[model samples]
Target: MGFEDLEPIFGEPKVEWDQGQDSVKLRPFLFHVSASDPSHLRIHVTDFHSNTWEAVKSVVQLEDMRDNIGIGGSWSEFVDYVIASIKSEDLKLVMEGHSSSGGAAYAKLVGQKLKGMPLISIPLTKLLDAAASEAMANLSLELFKAFKNMQHSLVEEQEQTFQLTKVISAEKERNETIQSQLDYYSKRQKFQKKNATDKADVSSTPMSNGLQNSPDKLKAQEASSTKVVNRVVPAYRRAKVRGAFLQDAEDAKDS
Candidate 1:
């Protein structure tokens, strides 16, 4: 149907309504209905510029039939239309006025149908009475922001501490492993050195002879045994000293 035909159904307003006169005016209008204000006849004016952000999109931008619905391609209608795109695509007699427009926008934000929901507006435009209630709200918001920041910092510190602890533990374990390996190698080296010294002492000494003709041999043998004992005992003592040093190093690492 043409625009003229759909006008009467959507409250056909005069194209040139003269003030204080019944002259035809081109002002737009919408049908208002509410149980509380059944007899309220509020004329919808399309020329009232929307001060809200929703006043940018054209109604006909999304749907073709939007222009025919008497909203006059207003962005408010487009916003309400986008919101109602969830469900109830039909613009019922229920949708009307600035309050209803706000309701529609909120419903879309919450993704729920909240018809006739009581709005509790906490106006921050003025600090009327600074009571505990007022201070609590302000303090709560600030504390929450502070707590979030502190919690983030604390978590980072904890992570760094845990990493440091892990590194220290790994180092201690490495030191222990090195000490164990050192002990094994030191003992092996000490045993090998003692064996070599003993072999050398035996080769250097003369063979045993009869006691009647063996004074020189006896003296040589005695010297060789003393030399062997001297060589082996020093290596053993050195091995013990190295073990003590390694133990001290390990204890220092633990500390």
Candidate 2:
């Protein structure tokens, strides 16, 4: 809750505007005090930032020229006063906050200590009760809205987490496939190196050693030729060649 949040507690409070400052009128709050007598009470919205706690105040209007009165606190506290007045059966007890501070208190007490006076208690009591109920309703709505927003956030978070897990699993599978391919290629390279080295050594040997004209030598050469014709590439080398052929085919398709 911030500064504007005070509206629920204080109704709608506005900064006091000085008439001398501008002719335009903007009124949301008002406060006054009366002190025609010592027994009387009063309150006012003074330089609040500089002042200290004081008494309830009520301003004197023309009709009530009858002196001596009391007032205090701002209208924000008025509802409490009204409620208290109704409950305690005494208006003077809750005169601090109201539209007209001392007026509200005097209106409640006038008939009690004076004759031929009418009591105006019903209206104030009803107004205060209605205001309190409205404030409660507003608070409940705010809470419900907050709960809905929190639920939405939780659902969104769960969806995001599920998506992340799918991505991670896909990457794991891709890495495993790449590792398998690397192992296959590595074995093929080793087989190719060994075969090439053995062929080179055979080629460097003397072909005509004197035994070349012998019948056994002729048989050996014939066997050797047959072996070469029947020789098969290692499984690793065959697989490597097949992979290369497939890659080439894919590249051709793209072109």
The top-ranked prediction according to TM-score is 2
Relative to the unseen true structure, what is the C-alpha lDDT of residue 133 in candidate 1, on a scale of 0 to 100? 35
Q: lDDT value for candidate 1?
A: 0.38
Q: Residue-wise lDDT of candidate 1 within 61-89, one digit each (tens)?
A: 32343444334556544434434332222
Residue-level lDDT of model 2, residues 129-193, one tens digit each, is 34434434443455466567889998999999999999999999999999999999999999999
Best by lDDT: 2
lDDT agreement of model 2 with the native = 0.41
Candidate 2: stretches off by over 4 Å: 1-128, 208-255
Clashes of 2: 17
